[model samples]
Target: MLFSGGKLDNQALLTNQAQKMADVPLMITFDGEWGLSMRLRGTPVFPKTWY
Candidate 1:
């Protein structure tokens, strides 16, 4: 599982390398059910609305 407190640039660099080695295109997606800040540090928190 991915965690917080990591540089996004580093992650992108790694993803790029993996994509090149991959035979098929990889679709990267993020699930921030809570907020971006929950997974990625230093980002603005987009809180979810609860009813």
Candidate 2:
């Protein structure tokens, strides 16, 4: 699933929902150009060292 937002609360709910239905691999991708520090709450933030 894909989502774009800076709201922590909304992201939390989405993450919880994804966890409950853990049958599929949830690839949560986000763009941080505008500052991703806020949208990445309660979730693992990948390092940009590779790409």
Candidate 3:
């Protein structure tokens, strides 16, 4: 799996990148474990507890 780690926000850009990765089989993920608001603006942050 591949993680973007909050560096991507543009759909067109992501599409281009996915195309480039098409030759390889992998999964892409983002950092939302904290909250979407932490990575993306204008969204509400949900609280979570980590053990």
lDDT against the true structure, each candidate: 0.69, 0.68, 0.61
Write the residue-wise lDDT of candidate 1 on 1-51 in tens digits. Answer: 243446567667777887899899887766667876667766787758898
Q: What tens-digit string does per-residue lDDT give for candidate 2 at 1-51?
A: 666765777876888889789987677776665456635565556655544
TM-score of each: 0.59, 0.49, 0.40
Instruction: Please give the ranking of all candidate structures by lDDT, highest first, separated by commas.
Output: 1, 2, 3
**TM value for model 3:** 0.40
Q: State residue 48's C-alpha deviation in candidate 1, in Å.
A: 3.4
Better of 1 and 2 by TM-score: 1
Instruction: Point out the worst 10-residue segment of candidate 1 by lDDT.
Output: 1-10
Error of 1 at 15 (Å): 1.4
Candidate 3 regions exceeding 4 Å error are: 1-21, 24-26, 48-51
Model 2 weakest 10-residue run by lDDT: 42-51
Candidate 3 C-alpha lDDT tens digits along 1-51? 444344445633775678787987546566677766667655566877789
C-alpha lDDT (0 to 100) for residue 44 of candidate 2: 54
Q: Cα lDDT for residue 29, model 3? A: 62
